[model samples]
Target: MSWMLILIYACVFALTCGFSYWALTGLMPSGMTQRLDSLKDTPHFVLTEPSARWQRWRDKLQRALSWLGPLSSATEPEDASHTFSSRLRFYNAGIHSHLAPLVYLASKTVLTFALPSIAIGVLWYSQVSLSQAPGMALVLVFAMLGYYLPNAILAHRVARYQQALFNAFPDALDLMRVCVQAGLGLDAAIDRVGHEMHLSCPELSNEFELTGLELRAGASRADALRHLSARIGLEDVEALVVMLIQADMLGTSVHESLQVHSESLRTKRRLLAEETAAKLPIKLLIPLVFCVFPALLTVLLGPAVISVHEILAPTAQGA
Candidate 1:
């Protein structure tokens, strides 16, 4: 029995080590790293510090893990549709990786198996005598939780990204209005705004930069604007895109349109802020009732209750 336990431990350790090695090697940026290596003898080549080296390793690990992506056994048509939806989710989350869907799926698969395996190992090591049926059921529950965890995290990221973009859009639009009023064309204004907003609103800046790149790459203005709206997945941004497209088609005054749009965005932002503030008390009510009130009541009543109990005990003794 001892030998069997030892063998199990050894097998688990070996499997873990093997997987780690495979992941590391698979994730390494061979093309980029090799190019760097070839350039190492050049005068301009600066050696990376230990921290930079570590960062590179960490980035590679992330990329590798992401590459494991979703598994699709559907027909080509179905797979394509699935991929499209997955891609949209990745885009919404600000994950630009071509393999994001696959990586997400892979992560889900790995966690679903890995978490339950770890749970079982720990249970066994602790010698918990769970019946086979119950034990398997617990493992399945763990697996299901693990499977959904990635999706939850991705959704959270997307929400955060959208909120950031939404908050930044009004400011960006105002800046664009200024640039347009100053005689910069739409393209130049976008590029200028992207550069200026980099420190303040990196997400918006990146989207603008990508739009600029698309335009430069020969995409039509309408198509590029549509793509930007699609990538952002925000109603406000979609409205802005539609407005810009209309302004272009109708040969309207870009500067005037931009100014109107900026004001509209500012009004929308203020409304959202007021709405959130209005809900704040309601949101806090649950904690105040369930947590704070209980603690306060305990502190306020505890001594009185103890005093009453003492008084009653002495009276009963005297009687």
Candidate 2:
């Protein structure tokens, strides 16, 4: 038994498990911490200052992986950061961090080797090498699964976040329309809507609120709208962004554009609701067939089958 190899394997396994567990079961910030994320807050300052032993270690590990962000971009210099960076993906999933890409890249690196190391160690322990078909196949399968698992998790996160945003957007849009009709500017309407939606739809509210901040900070309306669409990564939002941009450029009525867009979004939302309702029966059928129907058949036929068996068995035995 090689102690060094065993130690390396253990380290890799620990790192992989820690990252995956953290990604799946995220740390929940308190309500006040989440809402007020400023550096002056108690929790934020505590995390910022390396007073705790764990904080010091975490900061060291983060510095080690921080290089991967630039490495990811350097690997695809011709493309935009959003094209090659996991930043947009993380943003859409509500993970706003400069270190997210680094963590993601490090996870891929660890997982790419972690499973294969375990498999190869097992093969070696069994006196088999990768030259053999079974060993090679096992290593390949583990490696592929390791590499793709992060991607699947990210997609699931994005899907769930997007669903929440989609469900919440209509009401926010209606509020924006009302504000616009009341003679408020688009920026003011966005700010008011975001502030109003704090209780109902915080995620979308945060995005809208950020957009309004960018507007107040003197960013162009088009740029701010595009940022909103990119952060959301939703087709409906992209469409709205395009419409708003076009309206702004053409000097058309922003309220009219919003009104029409709001109605279209409502129609789409209703249709999506109908589609989901239609899918309910099909989704329920599998459980009915496999679970419910078996119990139902057992209840309905068990007594009859038992009676017939009793009657026929006695006659057959007597005869």
Candidate 3:
């Protein structure tokens, strides 16, 4: 029995390790970490000597968890030592990051332990009278619900944040264009737009601010934009970054590029609006017939039905 338990523990451990590897490797696209390499130059507070030692410890743990593999050894040119620290800080922040996954992991662990323990205790208390364990069935259902409900909520929040970022991005680009055309450098334009957009789209604003800081701190503008695209994980942002990088490499006019991108983004927004408008009738049909149409019919025909019933009933009685 002891050997059986040992084997089971070893199997569980191996399975867990395999799962961790897969998760770390598979969560993001192929070039994600390369893109995040830009965070090295963003302005952040320096650690004291003691703090630095503590940070090194934290970073080791993060690297293990980050599953950076070969990428972990690669350093950013600008702020080589501080790069990992900044990324760790970003991960800890509440802005649509991976805390949800950690929460889910902890919750599942607790539920896995708690559900069976509770079920066994209740069953023992009842003296195990019922065969097939009705209590066990209830416990299983509740456990499934408890597990899935939080996941569903997290999925919704993540989706909403992604959509919000996607919707806010083109506007951010336009703002950047305005600032650039006003004679500001790209970094300055980014900072201005980021500050202005804080109230409306705090997430995008924060990311832009980070990008501007990276650019100012000696990271190339193209590198910073690439990092921004990775952080947001949106195709539009990626395309914009690519466009900006190409313009930089070719020594084309930044102002003209920004203008063209702004126009293209506006057209995209128009198409999205049309698509949503097209969906409205389909989305509204259920409520329109079941809710609105029934109410309208009651309002319009109720009195006439009552009048006909009254007139016909008396005439039939006379006959």
Candidate 4:
């Protein structure tokens, strides 16, 4: 039974990998179509073949997962604020899929049941017997862990993305300041900065690119800037947005505002670095006490203790 279970798991894992590979390679539209489209002088309708079997399967799975969304919402209807916050989190983590929230909820639900089922299967296969209470408790514990796992992963992604944005903001501001001082309009400067920062600071570049896109799509500059700040979810970005809006409204010098904000951001970044450095010793204390100190003490006292033991052993035996 154990061998059979292991074989089943292996087959399932292999099948999943195969599906993933097929979806990535086979389902994606070929570059040939893009090249052909680029070469055409006049725009013409292009007829393409239907999606592959893998794509159909993926679409079906997505549809099935989406069903869980309504069920989840029916059970626990999120408030407008919560929905907005979830959207912000998803955006921050770079998930722009329309079905992201549905997929996330579905995953949580599936794991909540799947983990306990796996645990039970493992226990049954191992022939381990336990009291009913303890068995239920174990299942519940696994379910809880699995249920919260996605949240933990999302939180980590948000933290990492935010940190990247924070680190890149000062540089982006300096670039913007230079661009503004060089006679570029605010929108043009933003677009230029986005392009220039693509290699060095991709997260900020992406935000700026989206803002430029919104501006081009007919959004007001202030609205686009506010949306950018909201998507970034950073205090520095929010401050920059407010300053730019105020400067634009008051017809003040944007270049000067950018320069001043850039300097202040740099100072804040320096202070943050110093604060982290100051906390380094306290952070290191735990490892020093629990790990390094023990090893050092063992090394220093080990030889003397062995010598004493050897000398005492002979004397005690003789006596």
Candidate 5:
């Protein structure tokens, strides 16, 4: 039975890998393929002007690769950009961060098998009299759970990351405005804000750094910023980028425009805080009933209960 289970698991693993790779690779749009390919052509820097040994080695490696030319430049046919749902479909199917997806799926599969095996082992040790037929049914349930749990976890993580991005974006915009108004250019402002926020909140800072890199790589500032907003799927950042682009296009003073936007953003943040504060009573009520009230009642009633019990004890004894 153990050997049969192992064989079944092996077959299931193979099928999962084969089917996932086939479906995901087939669904990956050509544009993403081209974008990933272009990333290979990006020039790498290594502080060649004189630095540590690691830096020198990196420069040499980059130089060697540059001299060798691109491995293939045959110009693969490109597909049109996909809509958001289509993009998410590919991502969920395993286009982005391959290792994370594989690890998640593998762990889910292992846990599925592990849980039932553990339950069966416990039952055996407990001298339970469950028959083999019931045990097989439990094993099948475990296998199905293991197959689906990772996908559910991935969906949850994606949603959480999206929420964090939304919460962080407005602050990032306000910081950018402050830097711009304080006499820094866009690139300098982004670098400063990214550096400042690196320790406190990394997601928004990392996005800013990526935008700076794109600007350095010959992509226009607007394009890079728009891409940053799009990648995080945050509405505030998208609107901010649109405002910046319009300000630049219409020859408006960036500092003044950003100042106004920053004020508005701060107002929105304040309003959100107020709203959260207003909801505190509702949020606190559950804990008050479950935790606080019980303790309070015990404290207040303890002496009274003891006194009444003493009085009743004497009366009952006399009767």
Candidate 6:
């Protein structure tokens, strides 16, 4: 029975890995792929063929998993605002797939059950009786953790993604400013700056590249920038978009306005850095008190305390 349970859990885990890999890869069509497809008379859209016998089994498992998709999404409200918020979260986290929300919700559903199942199997394999185990409570805890794990992961990704964009923005703005001053149109400057930013910050570069593509594809400047802001879900970028749109409308010196904004961004970045530096000691204080101080006190006084105890114990007993 233990072996059977272990086998079942192992299969569940293996299938999960395969499903995640399939879902994540090639979900977002690349620019190069799109360009190549445009050249083709008819480009087919289908799942990649399995390269091995095992993958065929995996494909079947994934198909079966798809049955749970409706179950997960059924709980989601059919409001546009909620859908937009969900889209914004995934896009800001750098996942551009149309299917990301579905994948995310479905994964949450699977994990809710899978984690508790795995835990139960492990306990069984360890020869712990269900009654001896925390049982249903432990199962519920694991289930809850699994349900929220993807959310935590998504938030982490969004934080890192935003940080990357924030850190890269000042330099990118400076480059764009230079390009504008050198007489390049805003669209050309954006595309060029995006190309140059690839090595330094691929994430921002990709976003800019998409914006540039939209511009070249005949999207209105205001609409393109708004879309960019929507995808980024960043206040600073949105402000920049508004500034540029206003500058365009007012016939103001775009180059000068951009330069000013770039300088402000640099200053803002520096101030943020200084503020973080100032907070470091406060951040370190907790660990210093909880971890370092106790260890230091123990080491420094341990011998003397032991000596005092040794001397006092025997004397008191003798007296």
Which digits, one per residue and each the tens of the lDDT, describe model 3 over residues 170-259?
Answer: 788778888888899877888898888865676777788888889889998878998887676667778888988898789888888887
Ranked candidates (TM-score, high to low): 4, 6, 1, 2, 3, 5
Which residue ranges in model 4 land beyond 4 Å of their true spot? 1-58, 71-75, 126-134, 317-319
List, residue by residue over 227-265, the lDDT tens digit for candidate 6.
988888778898899999999899898888878888888
Q: How accurate is candidate 6 locally (lDDT)?
A: 0.84
Q: How would you encode candidate 2's per-residue C-alpha lDDT over 1-319 as one tens digit per residue?
A: 4434644775798899999988766766665565666534344212244459877877888998876545534544555765645578888997886667778877776787898998898778867767867668778878997878888999999999899899888888889989989999888999999888876777888899889989999999999999999999999999999998998788898887887888888899899899999999999999999999999999999999999999899899999
TM-score computed on alpha carbons, candidate 2: 0.71
Per residue, candidate 1 scores C-alpha lDDT tens digits across 192-242 of 898888657778888998999898999999999999998999998898899
Provide the overall lDDT of each model, using Cα atoms, as 2-decimal numbers.
0.81, 0.82, 0.69, 0.83, 0.66, 0.84
Range of the 10 consecutive residues with the lowest summed lDDT in candidate 4: 39-48
Q: Show how many residue pairs clash in every candidate, following the order shown.
A: 4, 0, 0, 0, 0, 0
For model 5, what is the error of residue 130's alpha carbon versus the real structure, in angstroms, after optimal superposition? 6.4
TM-score for candidate 3, residues paired by index: 0.56
Collision pairs in model 3: none
TM-scores, all models, native as reference: 0.75, 0.71, 0.56, 0.78, 0.56, 0.77
Root-mean-square deviation (CA) per prediction: 10.0, 7.3, 14.4, 8.3, 14.2, 8.9
Q: Measured by TM-score, how close is model 6 to the native structure? A: 0.77
Choose 1 or 4, whichever is better by TM-score.
Answer: 4
Give the per-residue lDDT digits (tens) of candidate 4, residues 18-42. Answer: 8999989887766556545564764
The residue ranges of model 1 lying beyond 4 angstroms of the native Cα positions read 1-77, 126-134, 317-319
| lDDT for each residue of candidate 5 in 1-319, tens digit (9 for 90 to 100) | 4434654765798799999999998887765465456547664222244458877776665555443222211221224443344355324332344233334434664676677776567556555534766556666766666656766766776677666666666676678778887889887888788776654455666667777878888998788878776666656667778888888788788777677776776787789889999999999999999999999999999999999999899999999
